[model samples]
Target: PKRKTVEKHGRDLRDIIGQQQGKRALEIAAAGNHNLLFLGPPGTGKTMLASRLCDLLPEMSDEEAMETASVASLTQSEINEHNWKSRPFRSPHHSSSMAALVGGGSVPRPGEISLAHNGLLFLDEMPELDRKVLDSLREPLESGEIIISRAQGKTRFPARFQLVGALNPSPTGYYEGNQARTNPQAILRYLGRLSGPLLDRFD
Candidate 1:
């Protein structure tokens, strides 16, 4: 059964046009459980490729599937009898606040990363995210879990999932060397939204 699943995934990968490099990177990331960053212009299938990663991954163990479903249930994520076994692939908007990504409130709850346990957490247009929100992931990325502390107590959520981020090379979504590109100073500031420390967490 597992072999058939992996074979089906391989066939799906073969259907992607061009981007041999992207396929190789995906293989490496999946094999080594490495975090990945995709920098490219729009319409390049960055999001599409990231979404297919879960399909390539091995089927979840029974315990892993159950734990993942529990988090989904806790987050009130529209769970039903079917589709509960599907591994999560959460992509919160760039405007999401630190609390939204990391989980916090008068009543603590699992955030996107937690909800993505045993699966993938994709951040598209990564630099558009608030620096603090991006930075909040640093610890959890390393620790493979998140601890949300409320006034009452702390709740821990599993976050041992692969991280995949996609971003355009420049704010203009075009080649940086283009004549009409934003000035160097402006470009630097734009990219600076992703701080050095936060980027350090990604492989």
Candidate 2:
């Protein structure tokens, strides 16, 4: 049987206007495989910049492709020639459960972090996510894998992927100078959803 293939298209860094610092940060993070966090107001092109990191990354090696494919296969996700060598990009919603984000089930399945192995995981609206859910990423981020324990046994899934997070500086999405809509305490409370340890994981 002939293998089917599909083309993978991603946003280009060139399409984004200005944000020179953001672009440079993406480039550095891509080059070093470091985690990144973008803190700014809405409409600042944070997500747009994060989307371009995968485009900046190099093609996956054969081993990397196989590892990624194996995880996808477990999830029954489609794999094709075009994406076989390309890095993955996973963006889960803030409301996602810990199990959903970190992988869980009676049978144990790969979660967003595992699916993003050898690629990038973009967490938009970072501060909006549950503190516990966000904290769950700490271990995997450092260990490069997640161990999901079950009554039957423990299943380990590769999760060595760059983490790119985006969030507004304040709850109202305005925090600079006179444009700030909320009090400093309120902003602190909003940003407080992300733990200190989790923030330490990023570059």
Candidate 3:
């Protein structure tokens, strides 16, 4: 095997996510069968932390690598042209619509979440995402797959990927602040998007 050895790259996933619990959490996610949410303020390194998992993952197999590459190729041809070594990583903005996150256009292209199959879906500012769009994740979260039904037809894509989400404690993205008193409604409205069923599926 001419493959290069794994690189710590001056950091490990556990360091950014330091803690016994977090270490165990990373263990579960690496298995590619769990969902996770990070509750913290800004500059906490949630994105950087999840990014390091690629370095730790024992490089993808040919079939797993191809499936991942194919999805990425649907978005960018260059990524698929080369032989990929790591799993895909998708970070979608909060304002993106349901179709963009879960995948559905007239022609039915894969969305950010689908593009991240067999890899990671990092949703920064998870609460800031539209309620409908956030709620749309419930189905795939359970089935480990996403089914997009369009007027043309239905497309099923493998979505068995780990979900990593980061969100602010308050709508203002603060933890302890007097401003929270004035913006109480904003916090409630933002969190209100997460329904009971959806929340239940996450654990």
- On lDDT, the leading prediction is 2
lDDT of each: 0.82, 0.89, 0.73
Model 1, which residues run further than 4 Å from truth? Answer: 1-11, 80-83, 176-180
Error of 2 at 113 (Å): 0.4
Clashing pairs in model 2?
A: none
When 1 and 2 are scored with lDDT, the better candidate is: 2
TM-score for each prediction?
A: 0.89, 0.91, 0.81
lDDT at position 49, candidate 2: 88
Better of 2 and 3 by lDDT: 2
Candidate 2, 2-62: lDDT as tens digits: 9966454767678887889999998899888889999988888888888899989888899
**Which of candidates 2 and 3 reaches a greater TM-score?**
2
- Candidate 1 residue pairs that clash: none
The C-alpha stretches of model 2 lying farther than 4 A from their native spots are 1-9, 176-179
Q: Name the regions of candidate 3 deviating beyond 4 angstroms.
A: 1-11, 14-24, 80-83, 182-185
Estimate the TM-score for candidate 1.
Answer: 0.89
lDDT of 1 by residue, 1-203 (tens): 55533223223477899988888888888888888999888889899888878777776778988898888888778753554555677899999988789887788888889988998999999999988888889888889899988778888888888899999877888664554367778778878888888788778
User: Model 1 has how many clashing residue pairs?
Assistant: 0
Give the 10-residue window scoring lowest on summed lDDT in candidate 3: 8-17
